[model samples]
Target: MQAEPCDQEEPPSVLWGLDPIFSAHARLYVRDILQMKESCQVPGIYFYRFHPIFTVDVLGTVVYRRERDDFFCYGVDDGTGVINCLCWKDEQWKQQNEHVKSAPRSLASSHGGFNPVEQLKKLQQAQRSRSQLEIGDVLRVRGPVQTSVQGQREIMASTYYKVEDPVMAVQISWMLELPQLYRKFYDRCFQMQESDLTDSAQSAPALLGRASGLLKDFLREKAVERFRPYDLLQKLVPLIPDIPPEPSTQQEPTPQSSSKQLHQLLRETLQLLQDEGLVFRKVISQDPVYQVTELDKELHRVTRDIIREDSKREKYAEKGCHVLHVLSAVRQRYCPNVSKVVIEVVLKILECNSEIISTTDSHYIVL
Candidate 1:
């Protein structure tokens, strides 16, 4: 499917907002996974989002009881693709135990000759109080999103609510359906291609039918788009610096400038360590190599001072550089995440300052 426009600023605040909400205004760090939602927001006026990827943990009410007494869940979209209600009635957190799914062992389980209207009133009241929240209100939620054959798209939410309206569950339910609706388009694409790929139209349907039922089942099970991933973006959005705490007179760094800073810091730290005898530079493969030996000597050094300044006290005297040791340790942990191509690109940028390293050599520029 072709990439479509992502509003980036949709309601329920799908857009990841600035960190640290100021005053009383709401701020967000939304995700589509219930597990992430719980980890993110603090207790206050906050929003949560997730999809059906986690149906077992979220709490919601029994919104619609079908003729067979099956329940349908509903809740707020709350971004992060999480719908706090109308989730987990059919599939999410499947009720494997027959006895558990039978009913709660409460008074509602017993069919007394009670008035239907009175029972409804009590149910609504309990929902409002966030007690026995079966069919309305709001909830604190977390988890992933996905669809079920038995239910419309649902969220595996953390919190449930019994609020003032019946329309919300239905409305949020529609919002949660976006991913599945998109998936449907993919299925349509596959279907349209199937018959054309085979010479025998009779065998074509059967051949294409070989696609895994289990895959389909898993996709449905994980059908809700509860998470915000770059994969969902149709095109590359302009890269902006991460939001900083409060505001400052100085402008923030752009991506290009930030990358340049990293290059400069690496070169400077390397030079400092080399001068301090922390790094024994060797020529290997026609490039500088380094070894770290003094890192063990400064285990007790104050980290902040070693990084930028030196201490004057006799007991806390300045020590040899151990930044190379740090560089080595960092290389061990994170070298795999970065591409060699990126390293080469950065080295080329550094090569642009060739007067300091190689006044006569142009061959070193190719890195």
Candidate 2:
């Protein structure tokens, strides 16, 4: 029987490198890795379904070995297939091993007491011995996939070490994890929503308006009170307009260009939302997370109450309550981590809802 053709369209090559999965080391069978498709646009990059992979982690037994001056090449067989792994030697460790071997035997007791430097040298020699592999020994290797001069696919190992799994526990764990990874991430097709494609021809303001509306709808539907940028980025990626290639050059967009466009759109949309009193960040952080203003009902109530009660105070009631006074009161009554920006947003929201009115630019009173 023949396999059915996939209906999903492949995402643009420029977006391939933006995916976090491409940065991680994929755990795949040697046979599958060898058979995977290589990207014509970016050589040395392989794809397993929609997943772009360059590095892989493999656990197998060494079936063959060849020594070089600076590196050792081993044929690793994980039962499915055999692939060559080029493991580089550590020059410092090699030198330490040589020094220990050449040292005089009488040096062991020459001090007639405990010698810390000599003991450290002995430890380094033992580590060097463990790293050296023989045929039939279990080995684990991780590195980027590359094509050798002979046109054979191999791994240029960044890390390689001998495994001592006497009872095969490590192998069994790896066997179980591979299938889960494939089912969850590797096997799935990268697809964009049809609705997003339909809006691709829309203007920039229209696109931002639609994205903001979608985010509002999502928060309402999901009842998300607080969220990080990543939680909403995936939902907005499809809305990013595809820029047409120049007719003169017909050059494809680079990964950096596409990624920058996506982030730029998201940043503009988020800033718009903040200006409209729809969302605010509670704390300044390298990784900023936002809170949906309308979703936090308790904050709105507490903010309104602070203005209502403080407005009636007799400290020359002509000006009502200052923004700073409300901020201090809200911090004590509500969450202490709330920022001045959050209070400003909340005050704007309450004012818009007719729950309060601004007595001055920096003061508010309950209506």
Candidate 3:
């Protein structure tokens, strides 16, 4: 977001665009829900507190699900802002509950959080198909108040999108929507075979990406998020540890034990990363030497971008993040001699040689 100089008596330039609406912090995005603790008080950044948005996964059957509140949609009207229209596809869940398990107010928060009145009204709505509920149909809903688009107020959809079946929709929201981004990130860890480290172009931001953003957020979150193949790839690339260009070694060499180890570890960690699902942007290719394939190089680029992106976030700040972290960790876990090369490659990530950094790609940011 760009801001121009203001006239006399005007506010600082920080008050413009998404900067004011989203502060950076290690965070995990599950489905549409974003989970993160405020890392710093960035001026003009929105939401000092962490808020979760639960999309209406199964609205058709559950629209009839009412809450303690009498209103059909949980009656939250934020003055003139957007309203969230939520539908619950309750038919399946209602049946899924053990016969002994009567419909509790809100899933686990048995005490309150879920209003029976609201659930009841939603049930009626489901019966009426008022919020556009249909079996095997998906609906895009907004949040903050229950009857979002239903109301005349302007509302941004924190929860919007459609899925085919209720079960699939729930899976999409719980695992695919927001969390899948990191899976693609983890997948990039293996962009090259376990043998591509000898290739010069394979290196990307090899360390910083491993240390920040969504990956970190995933490691820190209490819940597991989903993975979407495409979005995950797009978002994950930026969070990897892409490095600056290394002097070309035209004749590629064979992989060493250290190189193999790096690939093996990277592959394993990446798989674990998929399991971890949601995470911050901090990333590093624990074994850069083994991932020199063309695919690995792209992974490297993404890692660098995400690392930089996380740093620019209000919470990250540009300090105490470097290749040393990954190398040290690698050394502690396995080989000492190999980490030296890794250390060198890592240095390349931050070495701002615009002359060496590729200008071929439009997406790459040359610093």
Q: Estimate each model's TM-score.
A: 0.20, 0.48, 0.22
Tens-digit per-residue lDDT, 235-325, candidate 1: 1111112323233667764356645533443454344334433333322334444433222222212222232232233432334223343
Candidate topping TM-score: 2
lDDT of 3: 0.33
Model 3 spans with C-alpha error above 4 angstroms: 1-34, 42-139, 142-180, 185-367
Per residue, candidate 2 scores C-alpha lDDT tens digits across 88-122 of 98889766767777877776577787664589777
lDDT of the candidates, in the order given: 0.33, 0.77, 0.33
Give the TM-score (vs. native) of candidate 2: 0.48
State the TM-score for model 3: 0.22
Query: Candidates sorted by TM-score, descending order?
Result: 2, 3, 1
Worst 10 residues of 2 by lDDT: 3-12
Note each model's CA RMSD in angstroms.
24.1, 21.0, 21.6
Give stretches of model 2 more than 4 Å off: 1-11, 94-112, 191-367
